[model samples]
Target: MSGGVDSAVAAARAVEAGHDVVGVHLALNRMPGTLRTGSRGCCTIEDSNDAWRACDRLGIPFYVWDFSERFKADVVDDFVAEYSAGRTPNPCMRCNERIKFAALLEKALALGFDAVCTGHYAKVLRAADGSPELHRAADWAKDQSYVLGVLTAEQLEHCLFPLADTPSKAEVRAEAEHRGLSVAKKPDSHDICFISDGDTRGWLAEQIEMEPGDIVDETGAKVGEHAGANAFTVGQRKGLRLGRPAPDGKPRFVLEIRPKDATVVVGPEKLLAVEWIRGIRLSWAGLPPAGAEAGEEFACEAQVRAHGDPVPARARVEPAGGDPASGGTAGGDPADGGPAEGEPADGVPGPVLHLTLDAPLRGVAPGQTVVLYQGTRVLGQATIDAATALDRVG
Candidate 1:
């Protein structure tokens, strides 16, 4: 339980259904100084207490598990590493893929538990073949399928989402209030939990040893001075503080962050729209998406960020490491104008995923997840390795 109204209500419903459920609250923080603090992050001691009270009311045992070390290694360290590598990553996705589902589920199974349940607003269904499939929750606004995109086929078997059928967050709160849970009125937490003050750039600055460098325009001309390239992400416009106005008298956005030489590339907003996204570490929730076979591409809706809107795109399975003869994709569109260019010369599928968007996508940074969905069914997921070839249109 997250010590939130949604989880509390979900727990109550699970217990009422005679599931013999035992609530498990994850204590993610290693060193929480006192009972309360100015840090209003979701994973607080107050939340643990609320979870405990709710479990007490449900007549179920509530146990707090200290997964702080695992969380720091998998989520926090991965977050810092991705930023340091000049890529934007979602820490919550990593947490779900690594800690909550993998580690916790493994432990739970060893303890004789059938499946682990959470308050995530997503649904799981069985196909005609009895294979498990993931779907969007009934509540679209509260749908969290994007973050949970990292779940794999094996993990889905041992996962349960009790609040998937809930109509809305407000109604969930109402249900919690009816159950007399105090967290029913608790304000929803915002921003990353580890980010104490909610300033990601500021927090990253302390963790990553950002080397001060120059902020340059597309022409390689210096436009401003920045403390570090790691602090900025692709598509960032504000906080640039360029030294001189653009020659065109328009705004400039971050086109790239090159940590190698500590240089940031800035250009017009139009330059942020990317034509194709090449991603690695592809994962399917259970089975490969329909028509995602070798040399056979299919269209689906793809979302880059957790809360970002999904856009139409074509997904295809590609070879993990392309043909050694195609030279290499050093972050540029292939000069070959043939269909085989996107499918690879050999037409063999690999561990990589190639998403050709119907329209150019803006602000698509490296290391973010690109979750593909056909209707409400989650097709698969991939970690964006690079986005190359800007649309270059005004």
Candidate 2:
């Protein structure tokens, strides 16, 4: 139940709908926080207690599943690996993809449960043919469909979201209060749950073997020196600590990270404009839209971040291994632009998607997920392998 108001209210609604419900709280850490600090982090011991109390009040059984080992391997380690390779990874997306839906749902179905219900603010509508379609929730401000975009058609078949049509998070809190749920007033968690202190750079420093590196401008001239290259991300501007100001007297932002030689590339903000993107490890929410299986370009909206606005774009999926002739762009690093390291050899089946934005998106980096949508329905998602700047295109 996540030990939160939304999940508590969702469980109540499920019970009210006359379905047998069990509250499952995932124990995703070997050493969980003992208390929550405002909204800084989640999955604390206190959260588990709150979940248990809510289940008790609802007269349902509650169980705590220890998936800490799996979480570390899939989400935490993946985050470290992505950063070490100079890519920004979304751990929440990984958690939702690997742990919550895949592992938890698998165990739930094995126990003879019809479905796994949650408080995610997304809808699963049945098409005319009775197939499930994933759509954004009525509460657009609180919609979590972006993170849940990794679900497959089969997974959506055994899933339920009770808070789909709720107008706002306020209504969910109100319902929780009405039900006397203890977590009705609990603050929502933010930042990465594993890093309780929220010092991402500091946490990563301990996990990755970072070294001092040169901070260079677009022309490959050193402007300054950084304590560690791993701590920087594209679009970051505050901590460059440049030894001199730009010749144009304008601010400089990180445009790329080259961990191979520990070089951080900085330039004027305009250099961050991304017009093209390539992604791998593609997965669809449900059935592929018409023509997607045939690698046809189609109009859709692409969303990079969880809460970022969707952008108008055209996207097409390529058969496994991608098109060899166009694997790299004019200004792409082999680590990002060309075939991903260890990718399947040519002619071997694998998944990849290419996208062109109607308008340039700023600071898009490799390792982020790009979710494709048509109107409010989620079409599919892929982990971005590369992003090409608008002006750098050949």
Candidate 3:
């Protein structure tokens, strides 16, 4: 629990369900004693104390578990590396995968707890065959199924989300207030808890080795210079130092970030329209049926980035082979072929799942997750390996 209102109420509900509950707050960072201060966000000494206080009021045992070293290596390091490589990374998904489910779940099992619970707004259901499946929460607006999609079946089996079947956020808060919990009116932690003031770029620059780079147009013409290539993300429009207006006086958008050459490629809006997306690092809560093989086209709504509306698409899953025929192209191959040997480039090594959109998408960025779904059920997800215009494909 992070000592937030949702978690505090979740603990209360668990105890009301007649289960012996013990609250465990994870210490995910180690700051100096002098620097310690109170905050509602996680990983802070203040948040830990709040969690302990809630547990104390409920008369349940509470303890802080130190997982700082593992969290840094898994979530923090991966966040910096993804930005440096010119792909946007979802650190929340990383935290859920590494910390919440993997690390915390393992510890809970070791401590003889039958199940590990969280305040996430998602639900788990048992199918007729007794297999577990994750579902959206009662409050559709607050559903966190996208981040929780990374959880495996084993993790789900041992996991309990008490707030999943609850009413709205308002209802949860009212219950806490009625029960007289100290954190009843505590505000939610909006940004990444560990990231203060929500300046991820600044935080990343401090940890990673970043060098200033040139901002260029599509034809490699230098338009401006940026502080660092790692600081910018695909589709970003602000903070760019493009001094002059375009021919049409419209703002330009980030089309690509060439990390190898340290260039941020900016172009007109039309140049950002991507009709094809190829992804790697595929993961699924449950694998699709055997018939859902690569080159076997299936129709579903694919979300290239979180919070964006899903788009109609035809997907052909390719499993670890360069089957050019199976993958659909918007057009033909680019004039310049594959990248030079020993250099990381688009279409490099990794698991590949090719998606052909029914319509073009704007601001499609590599390194974002593309979650595939059939209605509410998540089919699977893959990392945005490459985003290309229909004209670029052959």
Candidate 4:
């Protein structure tokens, strides 16, 4: 449980369903704060107490598992590394992909547990052949399937989400109130949990060495300077402190960041339009779609952010043949050099998912994840290695 109303209610429902349920609150921080600072972050000591109270009320055992070291290695360090490489990453997705599902589920199964249930607002549907399929929840506004898109077929079988059928978050809160749960009115957590103060740039600055660098425009003319190129993000219009404005008197946004030489690129907003995306480190929530294993194109929807709109798109898997050491684009996964899992060892990249969007996605960046879907079912996800503008698509 997250010490939130959703998880509290989810545990109540699981007990009502007559299943033996145990409430587990992962202690992900090495030194968590004693109190929550409103809704800015999570996994604090206050959250753990709230989770314990909820489990007590439900007449079930509750335990706090210390996965702080693993969390730091997988999520915190990865976030810093991605930023240092001039790429934006979603730490929540990484947490779900590595810690919650992989580590926690593995431990649960080893202890003879049936499954690991959570408060995520997603559904697991069983096919006619009894295979599990991940789908969007009933409440679109609260759907979390995008972050859970990294789950493999084997992981989905050991997962359960009790909030799948809830109409809204309000309903979950109301149910918590009905159950007399103390966290019924607890505010939902936001921002990065590790950065409790909510100052991401400041937190990152402390972790990554910052060097002042030149900020340039599309014409290769220097417009201003930044204290640290790593602190800026794509589509960011604030904090540029550009001394010279555009000739047309229009504001420019961050178009790119070159960490190699600490160069920050700024341009008109139109330059942020992206029409193509090439992703690596591919992972599927279930079975590979038909023809996807054979390198044939298929129709699907792609979502870059957790709550971003799903765009109509076509995707295909194709061999990216080259020396793995020198083949990958900037922001590609470090493991991109090795042969993909479950693929033949031919000394090639095996495959990379290429997506063509029907409409332009603004400010799409490398190191971001793209979740694929067909209707409400999640097909898979990939970490973006590069994005191409319409004019550059040939």
Candidate 5:
């Protein structure tokens, strides 16, 4: 639990279901925040105390597990590195994959718990064949299944989401208030939980060594100066501080960040449109069905980032040969213009698949997840490796 109201209510619901629930709060980091006197992020000392208090009221046991080292290495470091490479990273997805589901789940199993439960606003269902499937929550506005598409089959097997079937967030809060839980009225934490001030650029600047660089227009003309290339992300429009005016007086957007050259590229809004995304690493909850062969292509809905609508696209399963797919139409055929080659002839699909969007998508960023879906069922997800405009290359 992240010591949030949702998880608190989830723990209570688990007890109401008559299961032997042991509340586990992961101490992922001890980073200081400006909230309470000694509080860090959501998992702060005060928040954990609130969790323990809820457990006490529910007559269940609670424990705090320290996984700070793993969290820093996996989630924090990865976030910094991804930004340094001129990509927008989603730390929450990384945390859920490496910490919550992998590390915490393993620990819970070692402790002999029947299954691990969380307050995520998504549901776990059984397919017609009784296979596990991840679905959007009843509360559509609060659905979080997109980031959770990274769960492996093993993780899904031993996981429980009590709030998935629960009512809306308001109703959950009402239930907590009815139970007199302390966190019932706690404000929902926004932004990255670890970055309390919501200044990721400031936090990143302090953590990594940076050099002043040029902010250039699409024509390579220097427009302004920035603290670092990693400070910006694709689609960023504000705070550019470009002193020049566009010929058309239209707004400008960040088209690209070239860390290698220490340059931030700005251009008209139209140039920001990207027609294709490539080199995605897909991870399914379970292996695909039998007879599904590597290099086999299928049509599915692909979501390039969280809170974005899923788009129709074709996914071609590729072998893990380290030669990532390159250049494809945003929503058209793969850049190779045919079946993906070099995939193993064996029926076993590799851990990665290459997806080509039918049309360019705006604000496609590297390091964000591109999750695939079959209707409401989550197929898998991959870290976005690259995005390109339809008319640029391929």
Candidate 6:
């Protein structure tokens, strides 16, 4: 329950529905002993105790499961490896994919639980044929469906979200208060829980080797020097501290980060606009579109990040091949000639996505997830392999 009001209310709702609910708080941190600082926590002892207290009030059993090792291997290490490879990863998605649904849900099923219920702000409705269909939460402002996009069709069957019907976060909090839960007024966690201060670049530097590198312009002329290329993301603009401004005095954004070459490329903002997004490790949340075939175009709204605007696009499932899965340009493996920890073993990746955005979008980064949807229903998802600028496609 993460010791939060949302999950507490979710548990209450489940209990009200006559389900024998057991509240299990996952101990995701590997720290020997630590205390939660204020409301800035997910795995803190304070949160655990709150979860236990909530469970007690609901007359249900509460257990704290130690999943620290698995969380470190899957989410923490993967975050570092992805950054070192110059790809901007969504760690929350990875946590949902590899830990919550994959690991925790597997364990729950083994223990005879029908499904893994959480407080995620997303909906799962039954189709006419009885298969679960994932949809965005009714509260559009608090919809968390993007992070849950990594779940596969089979995984969706064993998942439940009680907050799916809740009108808003405020409503959940109010219900918690009405139910006499102490966490009703607790602040929500904002930063990445593992990163206490929210300085991602600073935290990463302490974990990964930071080698000094060159900051070059589009023409390959050195404009400045950076402590490390891995510290930069594809669209970052504020931290360059360049040696000189452009001749036209225009702002330049990060065009690319080449970790192998130890180079950070910066250029005009227009350089970031892209129309083509190719992806790997594609998965579907429900049954694939009927009679869908390779190269057959399907229209949908494509979302690149959590809370980002969904852009109009047409996508075609393409055969997985070539540089996207194996090369740096598409944000694949590192130059060390081996699969990065947490990545699929060296082989052909899963299906690839070839999406053409109706309008060019900017700041598209490799290794981010691309979720497809028709209206409010989720269609499928893909891990971004590469993005092609409109000008570069010719």
lDDT of each: 0.81, 0.86, 0.76, 0.86, 0.77, 0.82
Query: For candidate 2, lDDT tens digit of each residue in 1-394?
Result: 8998888999999999999999999999778756778898788898899999999999999999999999999999999988998889999999989999999999999999999999899999988889898999999999999999999999999989999999999888888888899888899999999998899999999999888989999999999998788898988998789997899999999998998899999999999989888777889898888888676779999999989999999887776645444453322224433333444212224567778899989989878899999999999898887787645643
Best by TM-score: 2
What are the TM-scores, per candidate, against the unseen true structure? 0.92, 0.93, 0.89, 0.93, 0.89, 0.91
Clashing pairs in 6: none
Model 5 lDDT tens row, 259-288: 888999999998977665654456786656
Compared with the true structure, model 4 gives a TM-score of 0.93
Error (Å) of candidate 2 at residue 24 is 1.0
Clashing pairs in 2: 320-350
Writing each residue's lDDT as its tens digit, candidate 4 over 1-394 gives 9899988888888899999999999999888765779998899999999999999999999999999999999999999988998989999999999999999999999999989899999999987788899999999999999999999999999988999999999988888888899998899999999998999999999999998999999889999998998998888998899999999999999998899899999999999999888777888888878888666789999999989999999997755543344454222332432222232211224467778899989999888999999999999998886776846543
Q: Write the per-residue lDDT of candidate 6 for residues 1-394, one digit (tens) a residue.
A: 8888888998999999888899999999877366666656568877888899999999999999889999999999998998888888888899999999999999999999999889999998888899888899989888999999888879999888899977889999889999999999998887778886678999999988988989999999889999988888989999999988997899999988888889999999989998878777888888766644444668899999889889999886644442442342222333412222323322336555668799888888877899988888887888776776645642
Instruction: Score candidate 5 by lDDT.
Output: 0.77
Stretches > 4 Å off in candidate 6? 321-348
Candidate 5 off by > 4 Å: 32-40, 289-293, 322-352
Worst 10-residue lDDT window, candidate 4: 338-347
- Candidate 3 has what TM-score? 0.89
TM-score of 1: 0.92
How much is the lDDT of residue 37 in candidate 4? Answer: 95
